[model samples]
Target: MLPTLAQTTALIRHRRSIKPQDLNPARGVERELVVELIENATWAPNHGVTEPWRFHVFQDEARHELVREMERAYREVTPAAEFREDKLQKIGTNPLLAPVVIACVMERHGGAKIPSIEETEALACALQNLMLSATAAGLGSYWSSPPLLDGATFRAFLNLGPEDRCAGLIYIGWPREGLNWPRSARAPVAEKIVWRAAAGA
Candidate 1:
């Protein structure tokens, strides 16, 4: 049976990004649940069925691999004079804060029937699905939205084609004991929506 409208709406509204530092490092997201989350992501709608989203999952000690690659990428891009040790420290330790880190990738299917933007939007929907799944599971997940998320260097480290895009990294885990999320509020939709009715017949 499908979820009731109230249940569905509540799930959507409660889904929020929990920062990596707010996650419990000692706990781990089970492998089976991770697979289920990814399955939910794949069910996202895609034009022409391009299915252009790809995921690289890192857990346990393996999550360090992503951190290491990210640090290297930072070094490659940021000049030594401008490099901040504190930022590199976060790159090295942040992934360890979460039980799992999923590297979100977007592959551009060259000359596909639909525009690349459609595929990108499909990927966004897929990420939303995964996030909602995590929320429903009572797990906290964070998706990094940095402007320069793992770029070419880190993509090559992940063995992705150069043309593929490094969207972001999703950190998933249980919230730490003291991690309390404040109630979230949204502005009235009336300020944002503009609907036009039909002209007089």
Candidate 2:
């Protein structure tokens, strides 16, 4: 059966960006569940059916290699005066805190036909779908976008083409025991919207 409108709205509002540290590293998300989430993600709209998103999922020992490459990229992109050892350490450790880390990418498929921005927007929509699905599945999800992801070192590590872009990294796992679900608030719709009446009706 399809979900009610109220159910859909509730799911959207209930979705939260849980940090990797809050995720239970010992609890593993099954491969089938990951595939289901990604399948839902691909349902997101794309211009001319470009279907540009690519997911490189890293788990188990693979996350270690991912962190090593991330550290290398961070060093290569950051200036000497701006580099932080603490940030590097965090980068090296964050992936291990979650059971699944997905490197989201937007591979250019439309060339000059479809704008790159639209492709990126599609990828963003895909990620939103993925996160919503995770929320419904009682899983915690986080999207992390470090500047190092844009660096050539990391792109090369992911084997991305020149036109492809690494959108972000999504971490997924069960929440740790005794963790409280976070609550959030938003500005009133009236403040953000300026609706116009139809033909002075």
Candidate 3:
């Protein structure tokens, strides 16, 4: 059965950006649940049915390899004078804090016919779907996109094609002990919307 409008609205509004540090590293999310979340993500709309999202999941000790590559990419991308030791350290450690880390990618499968922006938008929608599903499952999730994602070293690590692009890294895990569900506020919808009516209706 479909969720009621109120339930749906509640789910969307309740979703929050939970950071990796806020997650419980010891509490592992089940493989089946992870697969279900990704499956829901695949249902996101795409123009011309050209599903363009790809996920590279890093879990357990495998995350260490991801950290190595990320650190390498960070060094390769950042100029010496502009580089920060703190940022590099965070890149090396963040993946280890979450049980699951998904490297979301926007693969260019729509070709020249469908614009690249459309494919990227589709990936963004898919990520939202994934995050909402995670929220409903009581999982804390964070989407991290650092400058290293744009580096050639990282792209080559993922074996992405010339036209493909990494969207972000999604960290998924349960909240640590005594962690509270965060509250957030949004501007009124009326402020952002401009309604139009048929003339003289």
Candidate 4:
């Protein structure tokens, strides 16, 4: 069944990033629920039906591997003088804060029909679908594009091909105790929309 217009708008408005720091480490989201969330992601619009989105879910023991490899890559790439141990610590430990981690990879499908940008846009839409699904499930989630994600070692861990580039890792877990969901202010739609029905009107 499709969501009603009001329900759809409610989801768009209610979706917000719940940072890993604001998530409960003990109360993890179940694997079954995560699988359902990813399935929902596939429903996002894809031009020419390329379906360019690929997700690598990190959970349980594998989450530890993800953090270790990422930290190692960070240390290898960063100059010793510029390397902050605190930041390295985050690379080493942040995944432990979340119940699950999803490595968002984009395999650019190049052909006569669509450009790389369009493929990436399709992947972005898929991610939005994922977040909306997570929110509707009452699960707190956030997409994070950390610098460690760009390092070669991290890519190697993901086993992505030369044409594939990762978007980032998304963290998912239950909302942290005693923390409120974040709220942000946006400019009025009138300020951004330019209605030009006629030429130079």
Clashes of each: 0, 0, 0, 0
In the range 9-67, model 1's lDDT, one tens digit per residue, is: 99999998898998999998899999999999999999877788899999987887777
User: How close is every model to the real structure, measured as TM-score?
Assistant: 0.92, 0.97, 0.97, 0.92
The local distance difference test score of model 2 is 0.96
Ranking according to lDDT, highest score first: 2, 3, 1, 4
Per-candidate RMSD, Å: 1.8, 1.3, 1.2, 1.7
Q: How well is each residue in 78-155 modelled by candidate 3, as lDDT tens digits?
A: 999999999999998899999999999999999889999999999999999999999999999989999899999999
* Residue lDDT tens for model 2, 102-168: 9999988988999999999999999999999999999999999999999999999989998899999
- If both were scored by lDDT, which would come out higher, candidate 3 or candidate 4? 3
- lDDT of candidate 4? 0.85
Residue 177 in model 3: lDDT: 89
Q: Give the TM-score of candidate 4.
A: 0.92
**Worst window of 10 by summed lDDT in candidate 2:** 191-200
Choose 1 or 3, whichever is better by lDDT.
3
Q: Candidate 4 lDDT, tens digit per residue, 116-184? A: 788778888889989999999988889988776677897888887876778878888888888887887
